[model samples]
Target chain A: EAGVAQSPRYKIIEKRQSVAFWCNPISGHATLYWYQQILGQGPKLLIQFQNNGVVDDSQLPKDRFSAERLKGVDSTLKIQPAKLEDSAVYLCASSPGTSGEQFFGPGTRLTVL
Target chain B: DQQVKQNSPSLSVQEGRISILNCDYTNSMFDYFLWYKKYPAEGPTFLISISSIKDKNEDGRFTVFLNKSAKHLSLHIVPSQPGDSAVYFCASRYPGTYKYIFGTGTRLKVLA
Candidate 1:
């Protein structure tokens, strides 16, 4: 079976610029998630989508970050006016359903200078 | 506040030996705990997990133990292999919530 897929394994952007990351989850998966991993830290939940509907996004920075999963199969995460602190790896994962084991992608490393 | 923490930054073990990784959490509401393994430039992969209702869960060479009273958990890998060397993260999820909180990973090196 195919695992979660992410594009642009690496990205470099300047402060104040905008950047976006894409994710394609495994087929038949019903839950998708986005996470941020800063250096020396564990991954933090940024947002979750359950079949194109948001399940949780309490930790997301609404002022600068946004994400959407229109068809429930693919998702995108965007950050505008990126700051130096935004430089981190963006990981995407998917599960068969809520409370199931998650499979992750390679992640997109974003470097904001 | 950081609810979950992996105090040890790194651990080294010889191949074919037992390897144990520990994790602690402050929140009492967390009902599920999981362990994930990660390599450089790759996202975390699910390793093992245990529910609050159970004290232990074992799968092949991997086992997870949970101590509700102590608010602690651990992962044990028996007869560790060099391929098992990687960063391990502990994550917890509260009941009725989809959000999960993860701890700063612990790097484990199994020397051959």
Candidate 2:
């Protein structure tokens, strides 16, 4: 079985530049999630999508960040005018159900100078 | 406030020895706990889990123990191997919600 897939495994951008990360989850998985992992910290939930509809995004910094899962299959996370603090690994995960073991991707490392 | 914490930043164990990793949480409302292992440049993978109502859940060489009263949990790996070396994270899910709180993670190194 194929695992979650992510593109541009590494990204570098200067501060105030916009950046985006892409994620393609495992087949047949209905629940997708995006997380941010800063150095020395655990992955923080940014948003969750249950078949293209957001289930939770309370922790997301809406003023600068946005994400969408179109057609409930693929997802994208974007950050506009990225700040130095935005430099972190962006991880995408998916699960077969709303509540179950989640499979993760290699993650896209974003470096905002 | 940080709900989940793994006070131990790192651990080292000899091959074929037992390795124990601990986790603690401040919130008493968490109902499910999970353990995930992560390799360098890779995302976390589920290792094992236990519910709030259960004290122990074992799977092969991995075992998870939950102590609700103390708000503590642990993961034990028997006869540790070099391949088992990785960062381990503990996460808890809020009751009535799918929200999960994760710890900073503990890096385990099993020396061969």
Candidate 3:
């Protein structure tokens, strides 16, 4: 079976510029998630989507980050006015259910100058 | 507050030796624990998992032990191989939540 898929594995942008990442989850998966992983740290949950609805996004920075899963199969995460601190790998994952094993994508490494 | 932590940043073990990585969590509400292995430039892959009720779970050469009383858990890799060299992350999730809290991760290097 194919795993989660992400686009533009690497991205570079100047500070204050905008960037977007896309994710295509595994077939038939019901839950999708976006996470940010800074160097030397674990992936921090940014947002979660159960089908077309959001399940959690409390840790997300509302002022700069936003994500959506319109059809429940693919999702996109966007960062407007990116900051230097936002230079990190953005990972996308999906699970068959709300709780269980999660399959991850290669991630998009965003470098903000 | 950091709910899950992997105190050791890295570990090195000779081939055919045992490699033990530790993790500690502060939240008692976390009912499920998981371990994920990641290679450089690759996303993490699920390795093993254990529920709150089980103190131990093993698959192949990997074993995970949970000590609820101490709020500690560990991943043990026996007869370590070069292919096993990767960053290992521990994660915990509460029974009803969709979020999983992850540790900083421990990098294990197996020297041949």
Best by DockQ: 3
Supply the TM-score of chain A against the true chain A for every candidate structure.
Answer: 0.97, 0.97, 0.97
Clashing pairs in 1: none
For model 3, the docking class works out as: high
Q: What are the per-residue Cα lDDT tens digits for candidate 2 across B77-101?
A: 9979999999999999988766688
Residue A111 miss distance in model 2 (angstroms): 0.6
| CA-based DockQ, model 3 | 0.86
Cα-based TM-score, every candidate: 0.97, 0.98, 0.99
For residue B11, model 3's alpha carbon misses the true position, in angstroms, by 0.1
- Superposed by TM-score, candidate 3 places the C-alpha of residue B103 at a distance from the truth, in angstroms, of 0.1
lDDT of 3 by residue, B22-45 (tens): 999999989999999999999999
Q: Lowest summed-lDDT stretch of 10 residues in model 1 chain B?
A: B92-101
**Which portions of model 3 miss their true places by more than 4 Å?**
none
Ranking by DockQ: 3, 1, 2
Cα deviation in Å at residue B81, candidate 2? 0.7
Q: Which portions of model 1 miss their true places by more than 4 Å?
A: none
Clashing pairs in 3: none
**What tens-digit string does per-residue lDDT give for candidate 1 at B1-112?**
9999999999999999999999999999999999999998888999988999999999999999999999999999998999999999999997776578999999999999
Model 1 is docked with a DockQ of 0.82
Q: Which whole-number lDDT from 0 to 100 does residue A12 have in model 3?
A: 96
